[model samples]
Target chain A: MISALQSVPFESVLAGGLLIGFAALLLFAFNGRIAGVCGITFSLIKHHPTLPSMTWRWLFLGGLVAGTLLYHFLTNTPFPEPPNNSLPLLIGGGLLVGYGTSMGSGCTSGHGVCGIARFSTRSITATACFMAAGIVSLFVFKHLFGWSI
Target chain B: MNQKIIALLAGLLFGAGLAASGMNDSNVVQGFLDVSGDWNPSLMFVMAAALMVTIPGFQYFLRRKPIFAQGFQLPSLKSIDRQLVIGAIIFGAGWGLVGLCPGPAIAALGYLNWEGVVFVLAMLAGAKLRQVQTT
Candidate 1:
């Protein structure tokens, strides 16, 4: 396994970080929406017709893919291929991520980025829990089970 | 009308940033999660830089009303309850295991990977499961 710490992708990551920040800022300034992917996607999919039309949600999601492609086109750099191929693992992980985000009322974008920006107490607490859980889970998976998926 | 275009632009920028930041890499994300292993601190820098920009940017836009919308859809709940903690724990565990949170998972679709497609479909199904508990 390559050590990410040693060969850190410093430049691209920072560039991406600024872009992410700018995106969140734009959404806030323009739409008054939390740039939380889970929230945005779910609201578009799981809501009733009486609610506001999901026109923007679809466009935003579409733009997400378009933007990446545009980046590839302009920079002549493409995203790497998917590493994981396990069906069960993907399904289980997806279910957990979805259910948990719904239950917790947020995901990485909502809590990690936007929440931290607002300094919201709940976001702070939620962020701490999730990060701790990720660490503990990784420790157990790596050390105890000796599994790497 | 304008909001839709802005929303699309935001999404595009977000997707590009996600890819650029290496958040779309499951292995990289899991490495960042591993506290005892070969930990990657790149995510920390990303968040710090993001917040550095967002915090000040948020304040700057505080006075100005939304151009075409009403106001910011900021979270209002102040208290951290059981749901938040337990849900976060579950989410974190899932994230550590697969490193496919919603943003990256959805964006990964652009890569045309089977895993991304499968993950997104299953995530949508999982999102639907939420209604089962309620209804």
Candidate 2:
């Protein structure tokens, strides 16, 4: 863990934070959207493929992949080794994330970033709940069940 | 056209930021969540710094209409309801298990890794389940 932190320079993290904020600002200022990834993903599912409104969603998501590609191209950094979780574990985790975000109406970016920025009580509460839940889950999974990361 | 362009650019920047900050790495996120172990505080720093920019930026933007859209399309639901808590708990648990939240998961697809593909498909299925239940 310490090694991971040490591996990614502090400047990169800070710069990334600023870039994220700037990105949020760009979306809000121009499109009046919250820049919530889960919400966008949900909408992509809900709307018909040919819907005009779906255009932006598709573009944004495409951009997400492209941006990562750009990063790799620019830095020549190799992808991190994918975790060795079982198929069942991965499927279960994905299911929880998808369903929970839908029910909760947001995820980390929606609730943790945009919502918190707006100082919404709901966002704050949601963020707290998830953070606590993550902590508990990690402790139980790794410490008790002995799941390796 | 302009709106679409901005959305694409924003998404691009967002993805780049996630990649740069090491948020796309499951190990880093898992390390952060491992409170009872050798906890990594990088995520905290990311959130704090992000808040520093967003708090003020959102405040300024909220005061006026957006440049392209007629009005801000903000979430109207304000109540701290049970659904929100339960859903967040479930999401967090999943996040802890995989250390791959929505944004990072999407960004990681650039690697063309099979894990990212599998997780995303499963996530979509989960979301489909929610849709079925509601509708």
Candidate 3:
């Protein structure tokens, strides 16, 4: 088992801390949004009639892409390599996630971050379900199905 | 300051977390998702660290009267229905198969991982399809 403090990249951890802090600062300073993905996506879908909300969603998502690109260009981090998996599996998995997100009413970001942070009872339940599913899937795929990338 | 701005900021922080934690690394994520292989527990540490930062913020918010908004919105429903079970199963299958969830999948852009690209595209497609199905 990996000890909590032993394996972490300290520099990376600090960077992560700073980044989250920055986000909190931005949210407080600017639009006051909670940076929840599911809620944003849900708002976009459910409140399509509201152009302002829709516009914000697009802008927020754009910022996400822009931020990653900015970091990559600045630091010259190597790109992530492709997983050695079949396209069919990829497509299938994506479909499942879409379906799951709809059924669950939010994605990990919505529930895992904003939901849990606010101590939303619903988020707690959703996060628990998300983690449990992830753990169980790993067991089934690796042990029972004997699947490999 | 509105919720949109706050969300934008939160996303940036969350993205940075995903990147720094090596959660964006396909290999590390795959390791976590792979039980048959050299399973990595670093992901758990990342979660703990995130909680360390977030839990305090949460408590702080609780003490105050919504510094950033009129009031904090909390979800009301708490029943486990068929939708919940089915959704969990599907989500687990996807995570097991792809080793990339939505947050880190987008963050993987920093690494320019092809799998990440594929996963994000598929995830978007999934989201679109879900919209259609619901409507």
Candidate 4:
């Protein structure tokens, strides 16, 4: 019901994207790690590494939290409003996302942003699949189920 | 210690990007997924811009060894498999259902929203379930 031309937030999107790229670049340049949250989370949970090894991951995540807070304070970006969906939907959605990212080995940042930049065929394929599936899922949920999420 | 500091700063920049791009908002994401409805193509611009910087920077920076690391850590596989496809399918469904990916989810929590808390807890549980084995 809407054209993308009107809805696209150009300035913010561009600025934000640059920042994301910078973040990914710095992470790889310095720590040699992909800024993949799911991957990092898995390592934190499953990798029984020593304290020295574990510290960086925790710091990275902590910085994420801090940066978010700083952005809010500096820019006064309003916090996101919660979706008006059923609890079952929320729970199921969260579970699937967590599992899929783990199984797939990356999410948007790793596969979508960083992977595409690297020109990896696997990342390209995975990103395409993620987008296609999301579109189809949204269509089904809205048209067939008549649910407003 | 220096590695930890840089990592944290990297996380901060990433979070800033997510926030600035309005990705922390579930509605914006849902809008993007809603191709049949109110679609927003801002995500495309975000992707392009990110690639513009990273494609050159990441590829170029690697000519030299990383300052803190011996070498650049990157994924090597170029093959497609069932795990990748199935995982993407499930992830896409969940994203469409709630419009919260891993990065944005964490950013939302930075705002201290209780809704984010619930989703994160469920996500954590889902992740931990991987340790379970079925015989």
lDDT of 3 at B52: 62
Candidate 2 lDDT over A33-131, as tens digits, reads: 998998898888873556888999989989988887787789886776675678899999999999999999999989998999999999999999999
* lDDT by residue (tens digit), candidate 1, B1-135: 889989999999998898788788887788788768777778877787778778887777767777678777676778889889998988888888788789988888888988889889888888778756766
- Candidate 2 displacement at residue B43 in angstroms: 1.3
lDDT of 4 by residue, B1-135 (tens): 778888989999988888888777787888888888778767777888899998998778767778888887787766889888888888888888888888888777877766787887787777777544210
User: Model 3: per-residue lDDT, tens digit, A34-128?
Assistant: 55654555456452457755766666666666666665566676554566568887777777776687777766666665556667666677778
Model 2 chain A, poorest ten-residue lDDT window? A1-10
Model 2: TM-score, first chain: 0.92
Please tell me which predicted candidate would have the highest DockQ against the true structure.
2
Per-model TM against the reference: 0.93, 0.97, 0.80, 0.93
**Candidate 2 C-alpha error for residue B44, in Å:** 0.9
* Whole-model lDDT values for every prediction: 0.82, 0.87, 0.63, 0.81
Worst 10 residues of 4 chain B by lDDT: B126-135
Candidate 2 chain B, poorest ten consecutive residues by summed lDDT? B40-49
Report the Cα lDDT for residue A117, model 1. 79
User: Number of clashing pairs, model 4?
Assistant: 0
DockQ-based CAPRI category assigned to the predicted complex of candidate 3: acceptable
| Docking class of predicted structure 4 | medium
